[model samples]
Target chain A: MSEHIRIVLVNTTHPGNIGGVARAMKNMGLSDLCLVSPKLFPHPDADARASGATDVLESAQVVASIDEALADCELVFGTSARERHIPWPLVDPRELAAIAAPLKGKAKVAIMFGREDRGLTNEELQRCHHHVHIPAVESFSSLNIAAAVQVISYELRMAELADQAGEKPQWGTQWDIELAEQRELELMFEHLERTLVKIDFLDPDNPRQLMPRLRRLLQRAVPDKVEVNVLRGILKAVERKMESAEKNGNDHV
Target chain B: MSEHIRIVLVNTTHPGNIGGVARAMKNMGLSDLCLVSPKLFPHPDADARASGATDVLESAQVVASIDEALADCELVFGTSARERHIPWPLVDPRELAAIAAPLKGKAKVAIMFGREDRGLTNEELQRCHHHVHIPAVESFSSLNIAAAVQVISYELRMAELADQAGEKPQWGTQWDIELAEQRELELMFEHLERTLVKIDFLDPDNPRQLMPRLRRLLQRAVPDKVEVNVLRGILKAVERKMESAEKNGNDHV
Candidate 1:
């Protein structure tokens, strides 16, 4: 997972920010750093900002463009502070990590951060598969570029840790535990509706609202197979008891 | 909860950061913005930086001192990127939110951020009940004040939403089923200690370290009344069994 996360800084202006990015990545146990046309490299300020993580700087790959940096990457996420007019799959840092986790071995994952001043232009953002917004305060949303990198790296690190711990990764289809398969649940619902109609519990002509409410109740309960069986059994028992009583009355009469 | 947050900015240099701070607070559904002796205010640069959060800036309160800003706040948390010499009661942003949630009606909760150049002094930090450090990349730990505010505010907003939805908070003294009252637990611990000495399981002369460890284990367990009573009963039974055994042995001898 660590090998898969390639952090791409696109057109970073300050050497210090680049250094800081390296430091941030190292803190979260991410090492792969790619720089796209940084204004300055190996600057003393960057070294100062990097603290003890100069090794990350020493080993960082400086490239000419985002395309060059992420050429071989299968999944690329662009970090943007502003909402672009163009429609792209938008995700938060957390969601981005979830998307990256399963694609670990299959794809080379690259997180592209834009320039500090204007951020990723729409054209640059369009190059990536998804746009990741850090969910900043609406009033003052300008996050330092390095800070953004740190945040994204943190999410990636957490996701990697969760993967290592064998904990189910959140925010993916994998974690969505429905009561039953959709088709099965739908069939069960239909059966319940028909039973309700037969038992005169539901007004068949105007059962719109009642059926939806019942569905909601069942969904909230998230009945397992046994629970569903128990409910069906109860309904059957009631129906049988009523039928028996009716038959006995008819015979007596 | 939104109404309860007193967003205190201490010795802020950049008016743009101040504006961004206001914007961040507003984004998180927090409206209270207090500035302590900022270098610039009402600057166009701030207005420009504020983006759409000018409402927050317009309504922001400017104060002379951090103390004056946080004077009414019952719970004060100073946000620090740098680790201090003396460790304060440190909390993650999530934990800070937990503490802040209950204090909504009790007292105002202030989150303080210091100057961009030089962070809050030790004296200022000491005034805070707790310190919140955003987990960042260790190499480049520097986070812009506005970004820091955004993260903190996001946590607060999420916590408030969870609270409204009746979700349990993540920290504080939870109501444990096995937990006895402090006095009762202390008494029980003393009795257990005495019993241990009687049985020669604990040495009377050097029981300090062992007793503390036992106490810590019990504390961690947070035993309830039933569990405490059950433990006492077991201890009593053991003592009775020991006495009977000693008496039987004496008779046999």
Candidate 2:
């Protein structure tokens, strides 16, 4: 489960914060560290701050943007201390852990922390599916980026321990979400669209944006692997029925 | 409840960690910070790391020994990462929080963190009523002292919030061991051993060290309050029965 947890830091200005985050991740059994546009890298301060957890820094992925960091993550949460009037789904850190920690078995979970001073940009916040805040005295709520990472990492570790200790929030679906990785979902969608074209339900030349609309629908639906498999089965059965009908008509002619 | 909670760092070596502890404690609404014989203090690194939480440091109490640090704390818990061969009541951090957080209303609860290099020594751990361990990969389990404090503080805050949020929050329940305090258990053992001797079950001089064996057995048993009360009751009954048998010699008189 820890292997599937990724800690993403965006536009961090301090090198020591990167190290601090690595140390925190290792403490919490999290190994994946992703940095988006960090100002400093391979700096001595980071390694020094990492303590013995320098391996986390050494193996961390430095990406050009947030998208690259979160491409594989199905559940992405951004940390924000500001009370935005923008009306987003807001959760505190513990609540975030309760929802996100269990998903580690199902998909890659990314927890993104923004810059030291300003926090996550509104544009960056929009990319995350949920926002998490650390409860504090609002006047001195300026949690250091590393401290924020440490707080989230601590919750993640504690949540995992709780689940292991038998308080499992049952993921009892037959089409368990764990079976549907993002790449697998993409492949299943492609297969469905191709079958629709073969049966002329979707005319490749005169397709009035039907496939695109279907894509959007599927994206919103977020089907699990078993559901995706069931949809593909129906598409295959339609293609077989259409071919058999055409063959019988030719024989009669 | 937060006011009654104290975060203690024992024999700390790094100034930055002192600041880090303050920052993490303030993040979770915990303000009481106690440092026991720290190698350094009033360092710039700590102030820098504390960010806006300088108030926590300024008001921090510096003590000379662990005893002074925990003088007023009714419930004291020591955090350790290493697996110990000597048997002691062990609990995970969440369980520790669930049991200890509710006690803040009843008593001063202190969560003590050991040094960065060796963790709490055997003698130091003996002072704690219960031992808490944070789950981590055993290979690189050297969690910084500050990180340990942060993790426990996070759990403490979460558990308190859970109780206030109408979650019917459990106080460890199945995981909780309602053991008798050290002194109470000691008195019970003395009474039991004396009863055994009076009943001629255990000899006074050639007792062959049976009392020590009973002590080890009870330690491993970790009896809850009901079990402890039951054992004491049986011992008292045995002593009463022995006295009645002695009185039966009234026929000879």
Candidate 3:
């Protein structure tokens, strides 16, 4: 997971911030640092600010454009302080890390931060899959780029650490208490929809909004295999009971 | 609430950030600006960055030490991007607003940001009751000081707006559905302690530090009034059951 995580900085103005960025990344066990069109590289001020993270600076990869920096990356995330007028898939930093986790071995993930003065332009942000905003205090929402990087890196590191320990997840798979996998969850939803149709709970002709709401509710519960089985068992029992009652009534009549 | 907030900059070097700080504070409807031993002030760069917020600059309070800047403030919060050995009460910028909300009318609150290069020293951070770390990307966590101020101020403004809007709060106000006030929770805790003593679950002479542990547990829970009341009711029911059981046993004997 760590190996696939790439930190990309675009149009960085201050070499000191670049150096500080390197230090922040190194502290969090991430090494794939890429710079795009930095205004000043190898400045003395940046070297001074980098402290002991000189190795990160020395090994940094410089690219001319953001597209070039992220061309080979499977997932790209952009950090922005303000909401853009255009709509895009939005994820918090933690959620972004979770998305990145599964794709760790399969593809490289790039997290991009923009310049100090202007930040990532709308055109630049459009290249990324989603935008992650570090929710800040309403009174003061301007975050230093390096600080933003630290927060994102911390979330990534924590997510990676949690993945490594193989600890029983609060909502995911466990040996003794196995939860349904994503595929199973999807299948169950399909079965649920059919059952709802049979019971006339879902109007087959106009099942527009109900499915989304039900999906969200089920998603929140994150039903495990045991819970799902229990629910299905109850539904089956009810069906059998109704069938038995119908047979008895018909015989009596 | 606005009157009680003190925007503190510690060991600030650039005069521009000071002016920008003033500008950011004013933009967010905050005016209390405190500078702790700045390297330069009243510079042309600062005035230029301040824009029309010269009033905030002119009235800005200059202090020799952080202690002086925060002396009158009852609740102190420090901003840091890096983690330290000793853990203080860490809060995100949003969480800091919740912590500050209750003290709004009662006490002065100081939000301290450190030097641009080194950030805040651990010694300076000790004075803070809560340490707020802005979430950032791991690669470039170096946020500019003024930008940091802007973000923090924005959070405070949003929180205050929410408070004014009469929305159900997650952490502010005693009656908010999300969480009860700390004082009320503390009182409920005392009630639980008394009930425990009555039931002989707690020793009068030697409680063996149980109450402190219980307090810590409740603190961690951050129980709302509903949760607190539910727990209180359970305690009362248990006490009643225990009493009845003791009476029945005595009669049998």
Each candidate's fnat, listed in order, reads: 0.09, 0.23, 0.01
Where does candidate 2 chain A have its weakest 10-residue lDDT segment?
A170-179
lDDT per residue, candidate 1, B1-253, as tens digits? 3798888898888787786676667667788898888888879968975667788889888989875786555457787767665444566676788868755654567889988878889767755656787766555565667767766776786667668766452135443332244445556777887766665556787754455434433433334555556556545654564555455545544
Q: How do the residues B1-253 of candidate 2 rate in per-residue lDDT, one tens digit apiece?
A: 3788898888889899899889878877899999999999988989988877899999999999998999888988888787776878888778888888878668998888988888889898989888888786677677766677777777787787777775431221122235578877888888877766554556688877566655643554454554566557545644453344444433334
Give TM-scores of the second chain, every candidate: 0.65, 0.64, 0.66
The sequence of per-residue lDDT tens digits that candidate 3 reaches over residues A147-243 is 6676566667667766776653341212234556888778777866765564445678998766765564355445557555544543454344334
Compose the digit string of candidate 2's lDDT tens values, residues A182-217. 455556667876865654455678866454334433
Q: Judged by TM-score, which candidate is best?
A: 2
Which docking class does model 3 fall in? incorrect
The Cα error of candidate 2 at residue A83, in Å, is 2.0
Two-chain DockQ for model 1? 0.05
What TM-score fits each model? 0.52, 0.67, 0.51
Write model 1 residue lDDT over A1-253, tens digit each, in one string.
3678898988888897787777677767778899999999979979976767888899999888777898899888888887679678999877898988777778889988888788888888888889988776565566666667766776676677667665432211132232356666677777777756655556688875556645643554344454454445434544454455455545554
Off by over 4 Å in 1: A1-4, A9-64, A80-90, A99-107, A114-130, A136-147, A157-253, B13-29, B39-58, B81-87, B101-107, B115-118, B137-142, B160-164, B167-253
Model 2 alpha-carbon miss at residue B228, Å: 62
Q: Write down the RMSD of all candidates, one decimal each.
A: 19.4, 26.2, 17.3
Q: Over the full model, what C-alpha lDDT does candidate 3 score relative to the true structure?
A: 0.69
In candidate 2, which residue pairs clash?
none
